[model samples]
Target: MSSFDLRLLLDPPRYPANRYAPLADRIKRLLATHANVVFVQAEAILALEAVAISIARPGRVAVNVVTSPYGAWFGTWLSRGGAGVHQVSAAPGQPIDAAAVSACLERLPQVDIIAAVHAESSNGALNPLAELAALARSRDALFVVDAVASVGGHPIDFDQHGIDIAVIGAQKALAGPAGVSGVAVSARAWAHIAASPDVAPSSLSLMDLKRNWLERGRLALPGMPPPLEFWALEAALDRVEAEGIEHVIARHRQAARASRAGLRALGIEPWIARDEAASALVTSAPVPTGVDAHTLIADAARMGVELAPGYGEIEGRLVRLDHTGTRAKFDAVLANVTAYGTALERQRVDVDIGAAARAVNDVYAAR
Candidate 1:
C-alpha cells in the first residue's frame, strides 16, 4: 500500500464534532432505550464507574448482585460512597439466582438501589434481568445494570425493563472499537443522582457529563475527542443498522446454539445447560477431569483458533469458545470446536473432531 494509504491508516481525519449527538441517537436505537443516552469518551468501565460514584451515598442501601468480578467491583464502588451494600452471590460459572436476590432484598427493607450485571462475559452466564428489575420495582429502588457484555448479544429493552441506568460497549457483539462507550440514564435515576452528596463536578461525574457534553448540544467532547475511536464506532453503528439489530441478535444466538451442538459432539456438555441462562457471545464447556484448560487453550491457539479460559474464580476449570462480533460465523464456530477436539485428543482424551465439525456445519445449515 502507498504512504497515502498508510497515512490514512496512521493518521485518520478528524472526527466531526457535529456527529457526536447522532452517535448517541444511534446508540439509543441500538439499546432500544427511551432514556437520555450520554456518549462517554472512555471505555464502558468509565461509564459504569461514573454511575457508581455519582449516585452512591450514606444511608443508601443497595442489593448488588455478584456473578463475576465486574459485579463485585460495582458493589465495592457503591461501598466507597459509604452506602450499605448487600451482595447476593452465585457460585462459579453460574448466573445470579433471582430467588436468592429477592430473598436478600426482602430482608433489607431499607434498600434503595438494586445493581446487577445483565450478562457476565467472565463466567459466560446471563442473569435474569427482568426478575432483578421487578425486585427493584417492588422495593422502589434504582435499578442499575452493567450491560457491557450483553447489549448486542441479548435483547436489552431498557425502557421496557424499567432500567434506571445502563452502560454499553461497542467492542463486543457490536464489533466496534474499544475506547468509546455509552450510557443510558433515566429521569428517575437522574433525580436520585442529583440528590446524592457524592455527586461532584469531576470527569467521572455524570453530572458534569450531562451539564457539559450532553446539554451543550453534544458539540465537542471537553477534551480533544479521539478521532479513531469515534470514527470506528460510527462505522460500527452503520453496520449494525444495515444488518438490523434483530438480525445481529439472532446471529449471536445461532452461533451459541451451534457451539453447544459441536461441543456435545466432542463429548463435552456446555457449562450452562439451559440456553437462556448462557451468554450468546461465548459458549463455555467444563474441562474434562485432569485436563488443564490453559494447556488446551494454548493447544487451540497453535491450531489458529483463539480459545479463552474462564475468568477469575473459574479459571482453568472451563474452556470458553468465543463467537463474539465478527467471529460469530460458521467457519469460526467450526474452527473453535475442531481445534478444541484436537487439543483434547492430544491430552489422551478421545474426541471426534470430524463429528464435531460436522455438527457445527449441520447446525448452521439447519438454521
Candidate 2:
C-alpha cells in the first residue's frame, strides 16, 4: 500500500463506520456468548449511566459497593440517573466481602441494581466477583461490574458470574487506544431497559444503540465509523484470542508473583495485606523509611523506569507498579525491578539486589 493510503487507513474517522456495529460485534465475540453487548464512545462512565438508567425507578434503590476510585464515580452517576443510591465503602487495600453485600441487600430490599468494581486499579485490589454476583443474583438485582482493568488481565466469565452489565475499556489490559469502550449486556438487562420509563440522552442511550445497530442492519445507519480503530480493535481481540485468555491470565499471575516476591526480598511490604485480594496487573507497596515514594518514582523515571506514584490519600507514601498492557514482558519487569533496587541503594536503603533478581527468577523457573 502507498504511504498516503496507509495514512488514510490508519486514521480513525470522526464518525464510526456502521455506527460502531463492527467493533460491537468484535466485543460481543470476546465476551460470553448469548449475551447482548453494546459498543460505546465514552468509557465505563457511559456504561454506568446506561445501567443506572435501565434500573432506575421512582422508588427503586441501587447499591454501589466501592473498593476503588472508579466505583465512587460510578455511584455518583447512578445517583444522577434518579435512583436512590446506597454506598458500601471498603478500605483501598481490602476487597468488599460478598457477605457484607448480601447483608446490605437484606437491609435494603428495594435495591434493583448492585454495582461493583472487578479490579480496582487505584489500590491494586480485586473484589471477589463470583461471590458478589451470587449475592446479587439471590437478591434479584441486576449485577453491574466495572471490569475495565480486569477483563483481559484476568478471566471474566460474565455469564457464569451472573454479570448483567459488564463494562470494559480498551486502554488498560486490552492495550488499545482510547476513545473506544464496550459493555456486555445480558438479556435481563435489555428487558430492564425496555421496561424503564425514563428516557436516556439520545447519544448515550444503550437502547437506541441496540435498536439501531443490533436490531436494524448496519447499512441503514446515517454515518460511518473510523475503520482504522475498528480494525485495530479487531486485531487486538484476535491477538488476545490467539494467545488464549487462560494464558493471558497466567502471564498476569506470573507477573504479580514475581513483583511481590521481589518487593518482599527487598524488605518492602505490599500495601494490600492479602496476596489473593491483590490484582495481578499492578501492585502497591509502602514507601521505605526515610525514602519518599514520589521522589523515588520521579528518580526511577529518569533512569528509564516509570513507576506510578500513589493516588488519593496514599500519595507520596506508596509506590505502584503497573504491569498491565503490552509492556508486561518478563525482561521489562526484571529491568524495572533491578532499576528500583539500584535507586534504593543510591538513597542508602539497604537492598540485596541479587536476592531481588533471584526472587523474580525463581517465580519464572517454577512456572
Each model's total of backbone clashes? 0, 6
* Weakest 10 consecutive residues of candidate 2 by summed lDDT: 218-227
TM-score, predicted candidate 1 vs. hidden true structure: 0.96
Overall local distance difference test of candidate 1 = 0.88
Write one digit per residue (lDDT tens) for candidate 1, span 1-367.
4556555667889998888888898998877887888877899988888889988999999889999889899999999988899999998889988999989977886989999999877768999999999989999999999888887899999999999999999999999998988889999998998898745557578888878887888888777788999999999989989998899899999999999999899888899988889999899988899898889999999999988988888888898889988888999988988998999999999888888888999999997
Candidate 2, residue 187: lDDT:
88
Per-residue error for 273 in candidate 2, Å, reads 2.4
Instruction: Give lDDT tens digits, candidate 2, residues 1-367.
Output: 5556555555455454454565566676556656866666555666666666656766668889988667787788777767788898886556787777777888975768889989877778889888888888888988998888887788788877888888887777777755667778888988887876646546557777778767877543424444555566776777787887677778887888888888888777778868888888787777778997767887788888888877776677677787887756587667667777777887889888899899888988997
Which residue pairs of candidate 2 clash?
A: 13-226, 15-225, 16-224, 16-225, 17-224, 17-225
